[model samples]
Target: MPDTPTPLIWLAGATGLVGRALLTELGHEQPVLALLRRPDPSLPAQQQQQQQTALVDYAQPASFAALPAPSQVFIALGSTIAQAGSQAAFRAVDFDAVLTVARAARQAGARRCAVVSALGADPRSSVFYNRVKGEAEAALVALGFERLVIARPSLLDGERASLGQPARRGEQWALRLMRPIAGLIPAAWRPIRPERVARAMRLALAQEWAAVQVLESAELQTVGD
Candidate 1:
């Protein structure tokens, strides 16, 4: 049992866009244990002096085993298909890497796991992105987390410098077009801010839900809005 009542959060993808937002939100609130592929020497000394930082290599189980015991874990690992450059590479990052961390967290006594997946995630989908997201979700569930919350948000709105990425241009245009008729779009398809998704994850972490909580894109929008 932890000395304090607040649950320790195990965060993966600590360097990504969503992960950075989560790090900002959770700043000095609760204990956080982050897993990074290549541990940042300065980051460990700066933020997590009393906290834990484990360097993880997804290809090896020994690296996964280094994670500390945590009650809650959050995963925001993802890659663009272009960045992945191949279907197998995409699966390795989006699916295998996620499961690797999840299984390790479960083995280390993590009770809850939260994931940030896309809007149309379905294993049966012909789309590669959706299929990978859906498969990752399924694999996480199989890890037997007592409380699992999957957050599916559309066009995550975050303040980040776009590095010549064209993926979200249409979503941004659609949101701008729909802004005048905001009442029309369905909940699951609404654009959401990344901070709101982080808030929802924090809320889900603090509370216990009997059923697996799946926050559709619309629900995320509501929370984010």
Candidate 2:
């Protein structure tokens, strides 16, 4: 057990858009242990000093045995169909990989998790992306974390240029059209900044509720604000 200081937070997807923002929100207040599939030498010295990384193969459960216990876990792992190159590839990252990390962490004594899910996620949905996200959510919930925060954000806007990551053109177009008429749209359907979603996830981290808590896009709008 940690003394005086807060327990470590195990963060996955620490290189992604929302993950980057969350790293800032947690700052130095909460110690973090980042789980990565591989080492990143390009990381700045500050990040290197602040957080320790544990490399674990996502496809193999045995690799997770190396992970230390964490009080909080954030599962931000995701991939687009375009980025993944195929439906199978996309599902492998968004669904299978996410659950693998969550299960391993659960077994390692992580009692809480904040998962980044899509706005329209539903296990019974016809849309493949939403369905996969929903399934991941359901699976994680079944693991019975003390507190599980489900953050459902719409189009995530961020400076992806820094990471050499591809922009989702479809989401960009939707955001452009919606920005002008944003007030006309429902709060849950509006575009959200990656930072906002990060803030929401951080808020979830602070809660000690013993039930599943869902932060919809509309609620996320206010939580981050």
Per-residue lDDT tens digits of candidate 1, residues 98-189?
Answer: 99888888888888888888889999899989998998888888777789999888776554344223354555677678666756767666
Candidate lDDT values, in order: 0.76, 0.83
Query: Model 2: how far is 60 from its true place, Å?
Result: 1.2
lDDT score for residue 180 of model 1: 69
Task: Specify the highest-lDDT model's number.
Answer: 2
Q: Put down candidate 2 lDDT per residue, 49-139, tens digits, no spaces.
A: 7777788788998988866677788888888999899999999999998999888888888888899989889999999999999999999
Quick one: RMSD of model 1? 3.6
Full-model lDDT, candidate 1: 0.76
